[model samples]
Target: MSSDAELLEASREDAGAFRELYERYALRVQGYHRRRTRSDDAAHDLTAETFAQAWLGRARFRDEAGGSAGPWLFGIARHVLLASVRRGQLERIACERLGLFDRLDCRPAAVEPQTAWLEDLDEDLDRALADLPAGQRDAIRLRVVDDLAYEQVAAALDTTPQAARVRVHRGLGALRTKLNHSTEASR
Candidate 1:
């Protein structure tokens, strides 16, 4: 169990030491990719590509510039994962335009209890959320889901904190109305 700095130093000299570094950081790299990309396979591929890039760029590795190799590797992985997601989005849009997914919506009826519960919740939430205006949805996602502060949300949305607060309030109000209506319908 060598310290990270020691491992990085050794890895700069020895290929075997680099392998040890990879083993140590691979899971973390994968986890970062998983969070960003939301796909295990994509994360695994991006993690592998990240290590490959790190290993190839070892000659350029500056201990001073990067406080930790782990963060450097993660940064590479994040860029790669984001690029992959953008490419995927483009491909999906192309496929949709070409009608590639038209037949896929016809296949259905695989239901597990947990999946069913999650699907129901997702549908309900989607409906509740659909009642919100786009501005309100953006505010809610930035503030609540992304856990950003009001100031941060305001900056991201290019609005004032008061405006962001208003949007979130309206979004929550809409959601509450939808939930009440749903409950009344159920009863």
Candidate 2:
């Protein structure tokens, strides 16, 4: 099997190999953005940009943690999402400008969120996550939001596993308190 790292290296030499890399992770990448963004169209746009940028940066990419390129791709994605938030332009349409619109075959799927109650809970959770400090926030996201193991979380955050565990623990504790209070107030 072609490891993601090997595929990435090949992509640097033969651009077609980049498609293999994208094929391997496209769903994971798209799902991440789709879950976080308010609309599916925006997620599809960001997902496309993420791979496009990754392809453009293949020359500089290395499997720093000696593992799959999955983590590195995700890191790029998180940066892209953060930049969108910082610019207050999360809804900005971008694929047409990049001239790469033909690449993705994805379209907004037919679906509805579970219920309005669940949507309210999601909003509350987002507010709690936003209120966390950067360290704790990233830790919780890599560990919980992304379901990364402790070692993977540490590798992604450039921290020790122990520190990653601590941050996630503290972050979850704070989130619980915030949520408990919110629930009580609502009741």
Candidate 3:
């Protein structure tokens, strides 16, 4: 099996190698987007765009993080997701300016449980997350849940990269403490 680095190198000349890379990563990438977006259609589109961008930039691919191109691909995915959000914001502003806004109440519906353990974990995580301060919460979401780099998280939050790292570190520490407490209490 070709390493992700090897595949990326080959993909410079053979597009079929890129397909292999896509097959290896598409589902994982889609799942990452799905967890953050909570929308299947959006996840699909974001994953497609991530790969398309990856293919276009294959020549520039460098194995910055070991042998896997996972980090590079994810970096592209984050940018694609951010661009999509910016586009959505622009469209919303345009609609508001034109007085063409459709007032869709987009409340989150309850998730149906696939299993008891997963539900319990999710509930515990939600409780832990709710206990975090707003800045910490947002930082954790962007850095952990969305798998963005600290610099990217800083850019999104309009803070310094060190501040972003601090927020994520503190938030994760708090979450771990709370979750451990919760687990012990459960037992």
Candidate 4:
């Protein structure tokens, strides 16, 4: 594979090079969107939008500050997926206003006890995460879920490695506190 710099340089001058770059990053970008959206069709749409935006904005690409174009494309995919989610939420609100759910399939499914407990745990985890400051939450996600190195997380967050470590530690501590409180309340 060509270096990102070389690929970017070629893409700046040639359309074909841009296509190659898109091919290289498209699957990863789609997977990122899929994880965020939980829908394959939406992921495909977001991936297409990402590439379209990238192609249109290729002339403005900067090799210095942004690092590889892959991450930038993934960022675009993330934004697009987020926008889609917001739009869907708004649409649901509008539909509720019009009483559309009266005619829709609204059957409820039975939940198994194990599944219910897992769902409750997931909700608790989400609440705990939301209670954290943005930097702390991001640090935890990047380090634990993304499996990024401390240095990489620090660089992404524009902070020092030590600061990133502290943020992750604090975030985990806050989560543990919430979990303990939740367990006590259940008992």
Candidate 5:
């Protein structure tokens, strides 16, 4: 069993090697997107797009996670999902501008009680994130949301790994405090 780094390197010559990498991570990557989008089809599409980007960009692969490519692949997944979301938002805005939003029978799926609760939790999370300082917020997003390694997070934030870790720790603490307060206040 070759490490992810070895698989990626081998993929440069034998594309089949990349299949091993996909088999290792495809489901996890799709699940990540699924949890974020709450849409199965979108998850599948985003997973495909993420893998396609990885395949095309294989040659440029940097072993940031020692023998693991989890962080790199996840980084791509995050970008793909963000792009998809941005496109969705822009389309909604365009529809609204053209008065098509109201005209369209865009009935959303009926939300289950559990889903409604989850949606509220998501809003609370967004609020907590908004309360963080910029550096801490970005660090937390890279480390927690994107699942990047400390090194990768540090690189993205142009800081040391120790600093990245500290920021994520502090940011998460703040979020927990805020959410706890919100929960208590709601009671």
Candidate 6:
């Protein structure tokens, strides 16, 4: 097996090599974020950011202390996590200083009925999602809405990644069929 340093070097020139590197560690890093974060959604966001940062900084990767890239990746993941935390903290502090906290909505996933359009579609999609079996609905929610990696999706669902993927696919297919019917009826 080639060392991660070698893989990183190759990754600079070959996208496939980079994909291989990403495959080697993405789940572990995502799991690391998941364990530390409050919710899978936050963990998903941090994991995406971590991999993006790692890709951008691949040239800077050093094979320190036994040539495994896991430590280097974890370092980047840590920084990403800290940056996310700091951004939240700074935003909260700024909101406090500016007295915007009372004006701001702190909750997640609020779909306001005030939209001129698409609100109906949002409700339709919500209803369609609700109509799905719990396994499929939860899988779709975690994989699509929250943007969790399939591995993380599996962990949350207590199933294999492939099974989680199948549930998401089936859920989306059902949603598409239901929405198509709804659209035809409305027209």
What C-alpha lDDT does candidate 1 achieve relative to the native structure? 0.65
RMSD of 6: 14.8
Please give each candidate's TM-score.
0.43, 0.49, 0.54, 0.47, 0.54, 0.52
User: Per-residue lDDT tens digits of candidate 4, residues 102-157?
Assistant: 65542211211111212232465678788989999999889866979889999999
lDDT string, candidate 2, 1-187, tens digits:
7877788888877877889889988877777667667567766877998998898888777544343676567667776766655433222235445554466532212322222212342576689889999999999888766979899999999999999888987777677677557645653
Over 1-187, each residue of candidate 1 has an lDDT whose tens digit, in order, gives: 7755566677777888888888877876676555445567666777888888888877666442123464356446655655555555566666767777666643221310111212242454578777788899889889767979899999999999999888877776566567546544653
What is each predicted model's overall lDDT from 0 to 1? 0.65, 0.70, 0.74, 0.66, 0.75, 0.71
Candidate 4 segments exceeding 4 Å error: 65-67, 91-187
lDDT tens string, model 6, 13-57?
997887888888777777666656535776677788998998899
Error of 6 at 11 (Å): 1.5
The superposed Cα distance between candidate 3 and the true structure at residue 124, in angstroms, equals 17
Error of 4 at 121 (Å): 18
Q: In what order do the candidates fall by TM-score, top score first?
A: 5, 3, 6, 2, 4, 1
Count clashes in each candidate, considering only residues at least 3 apart in sequence or on different chains: 0, 0, 0, 0, 0, 0
Candidate 1 — which pairs collide? none
lDDT of 3 by residue, 54-154 (tens): 98899988553345776567668767777776656666667677766555532222321122212232565678889999999999889867979889999
**In candidate 5, how many Å is residue 161 off?**
13
lDDT for model 5: 0.75
> Which is the leading candidate under TM-score?
5
Give the poorly placed runs of model 3, Cα more than 4 Å off.
Answer: 99-187
The count of backbone overlaps in candidate 2 is: 0
Candidate 5 stretches with Cα past 4 Å from truth are 95-187
